[model samples]
Target: MSDLQVGLISLGVVLILVVLVFNWWQDRRMRGRMREHFPETDRDPLMGDVTPAPGRREPGLHLAPASGDLPAEDAVDVDPNCEAVIDVTFAQPVPSDRLHAATQALRAVGSKAVRLFAKNDNGDHRAILREGESYASVQLAVLLANRSGPLTDIEWSQLWTMAQNLAERFDGSVEGPEQARVMARASQLDALCAGLDAQVGLALRLGGTRPVADVTRQVKDAGFMLHDGQLAWLSEAGMPRFVLLYDGVQVRDVQSDGVDRIDLLLDVPNSPADSQAFSRMASVGRDLA
Candidate 1:
C-alpha cells in the first residue's frame, strides 16, 4: 500500500480506539455516580420481604403505607391500587408553598396524572397546600391508567426525574417501589379498567350530501347543543349524554363541501349509572336513525 494510504488506515484505527475508550470512561463515571446515589442493599427497604405467604396471591405493586412519619391525607388523593408512588422525606420541615411551587410542573407526566400530598406538623396529609403550614415529607403519585392507556416507560422515567429533582431541591431522600413492579401493576390496572370501559356509537348515512349549516341547524333543532365543538345531547343535570360528530371530526371543524355521514357516541364510563344509560342511548340512536 502507498505510504499515504497506510497512514490513513492507522489514523482510522486510532480514532476507533479513542471513541471506545471515551465511551468506557463515560460509562464508568455514570456507574460511580449511580453507586453513590443508590448503594447496594441486601433487601429493598420499601418492599420488605417479598416472599408470598401460603395460599395467598402475590402482593400487588404498592409502596408500604407511609409510616407514622408520613401523611394520612394520602388516602384522599392517592390510590395505591392504581398509582405508582414515590416518597420524598426532607431533612427538615419546609414551607408548604415552596414545595407546592416546586411540584407544579410535575402535575402531569405524559398523559398520566400526577398528584402531590404533604404531611403538615399536625400529622395530617393534605392535597391542598396551606401557605403558612410547614411539611416534613411529601408523596408523589402517578395514575397508572386512564382512557388513553397504561403508564408508559417514558412517563415513568419522567416521574422519576421529577421526584429526583424534588429530592435534590429539598435536601430529601427519595424512595419508591421497583420500576418493574410498578410497570406490572400499571398493566394490570389498565387491563381491569379496559374491561369495564364501554363506548357506544351509531352512524347516520344520508342519501345525499347536505350543507354543514343545514345539518347543524337540524341537529340543534333536535335538541343537541354545541359543547367543545361537538354536538351534545345533555341530561337535566347538564352532563353530556351523547356527542355528535360529522365524519369523525368536530361539527364546527368540518370544512368539506357537505356532510354525508355523522356519528353519535355515548361514553358509558362517564355517564350516570342510574340513568339506564345504554337503554336511553339505544333509544336515542333509533330515533335519530
Candidate 2:
C-alpha cells in the first residue's frame, strides 16, 4: 500500500467521525430543549388550575388540549370544554329560497352547518324540510361548538343579529332562549364531559397478510359507515358517538413484495361518552374480529 493512499483513507475516516459527533451533539441539545419546554408529566399545567369565564381564552393562543389528565373539573377551560346548540324560530313559514339565503348569511357569521327544521302537527321538529316548502313556522338550529370553544357574547350577538335579519325577511318574529341561560347550560355540559371518560380509544392491529381491501370490507360489514378514513358510528341524535380510524402500521422488513396492514383505531369523545358507549365500542370491535 502506498503511504499517500493510506493518508487519504485516514482523512475520510476522521471526517466521518466528526460528522457523527456533530449529530450526537445536535440530538442531545434537542432533547434538552424539549425537556425544558415540555416536561415529562402525566398532567399538563398549561390547561389551567381553574376554568375561566365563558368566551375568555388566554390571548395569543387558540388551541385547547383535547385529551389529558385534569386534576379537577374546574381545571378545564370553560370555553373549549363546552359545546352547545341554539335555535331561532320564526313567526311564519319562510320560502325555501329565503331560507337558503338566510343560511348563507349565517354561514358568513360562523362557518358551520345551519340545520333547519319544520314543526309537525304534534310540534315535533322534523329535519330535512325542503328549501322550497313554505310552512306556517320553521326553526333554525345553530351549533356553537364548531366555531368557538363555548358560547361567547360575540357569537351570541352574531346569531341574534342573523335571527333578526331572518325575521325581517320573513316579516315574522324571532324566538329563542336567553343568552344567560345558554351560557349556564354550557358550564353544566362542560362539567359533565369532565366527569365522564371524555375520550377513549382502542386500536385493532391487523398483523395478517390480508389485503387492505378485504380488511376494509370486514370493517364495513361490522356496521361502520366509511367517511374519509374514519369508520364512524352515529348516535340516534345524528352525532358521531364513536369513530374507527385507519392508520397503516410499519413493516419491519422490506421484501420484493410489501405487506399490507391496517390499524383500526376506535375513538370515542365525551359528547355522549358513558359506559354504554365503551360497551358498544367493545362489542363492535369483537364482532369485527
Candidate 3:
C-alpha cells in the first residue's frame, strides 16, 4: 500500500479506538452516579435477572430481599403503575384518637404511586383528610406504576407488606381486592393503555390576517374552558371528558403570517375504552373541522 493510504488507515484506527475508550469512560461514570443514588443492596432473588436487551431502557426496582422490603423513595421508579386503581378499604373503622397518626402514616409510607382516599358523610370520595377531622373508614387507590405495568409476585408482596404495616399501626384493617381479581383487572387495563390511539385536531388558518388573540377567543367561544394550562370541553356534570390544546409549531410559525392549529386529544387511557367515548370525540373533531 502507498504511504499516504497506510497513514490514513492508521489515523482511522486511532479515531475508532478513541471513540471506544470515550464511550467506556462515559458508561463507567454513569454507573458510578447510579450507584450513588441506589446503594448496593443484598440482591433479592425475587427481582429475577437483569438481562441486557437491545434498545431496552426500562429501570428495574432492585429489591433487597424476597421478603418484601421496599427500596429508597429517591430511587423510586417513574413509570405508570400497572394497577392505577387499587381499592383499599379498612377492615375496622379508625378511631378518632389514632386518626392523625393513621393519616400521616398512610401519607408518609410507600412511594408516590400510593394515594389514600375516603368518603365523607355526604357520600363524596376525596383524598387528603380534613384537618382536626376523623374518617369513619378509609380507602387507598395506590398507583402500581413503579414496578412497571403489571404487578409481579414480588411487587404484590411488597404492597401487602406496606398495607400490613399501616393496618398494624392504625386501627385500620387493610382490605384489598382478591389477588386473582386485582391481577385480572390490572392486566385488562394495561392492555387497553397499550392499544390506546386517538388524537383529533383542526388547523385554523389565520391567513396572516387576524391576531393570535383571536385564536384563543374562537376556542373559548366554542364553549371550551381553559384552566391550569389545559383546555377541556367538560360534560354536563363539569367533568372534563377531553382536552383542547393549541398546537405549537416552530417558534416563528406562531409569529406574524405563520400557520396556527388546535387539537382535541381524547386520552383513551384516562377515559373509558368504549366506542361511545370514541364516537363522541370523533364527532367533536368533525364539528371543529
List where candidate 1 sits over 4 angstroms from the true fold. 1-77, 199-265, 270-289
Candidate maximizing lDDT = 1
How are the candidates ranked when ordered by lDDT, highest leading? 1, 2, 3
Pairs that collide, model 2: 96-131
Clashes of each: 0, 1, 3
Cα lDDT tens digits for candidate 2, 1-289: 9999999999999999999999779667655654564454444332335444487322111112334442212222213233333444556665545555555444323443344455423353434334234544555554444313444566667767876776677676777778887767655664564566435555554544665556657767877674444557767765566766545332222232433443333343434433355556655654454
lDDT of 1 at 110: 88
Clashes of 3: 3
For 114-200, candidate 1 gives per-residue lDDT tens digits of 877778777777766665678888888899988789998889989888888989998999999888888889899999998887777
lDDT of each: 0.75, 0.51, 0.51
Q: Is candidate 2 or candidate 3 better by TM-score?
A: 2
Candidate 2 ranges beyond 4 A from true positions: 1-92, 107-114, 120-125, 144-148, 197-289
Reference-based lDDT, residue 19, model 2: 95
What TM-score should be assigned to candidate 3? 0.33
* List of clashing residue pairs for candidate 3: 80-145, 81-144, 81-145
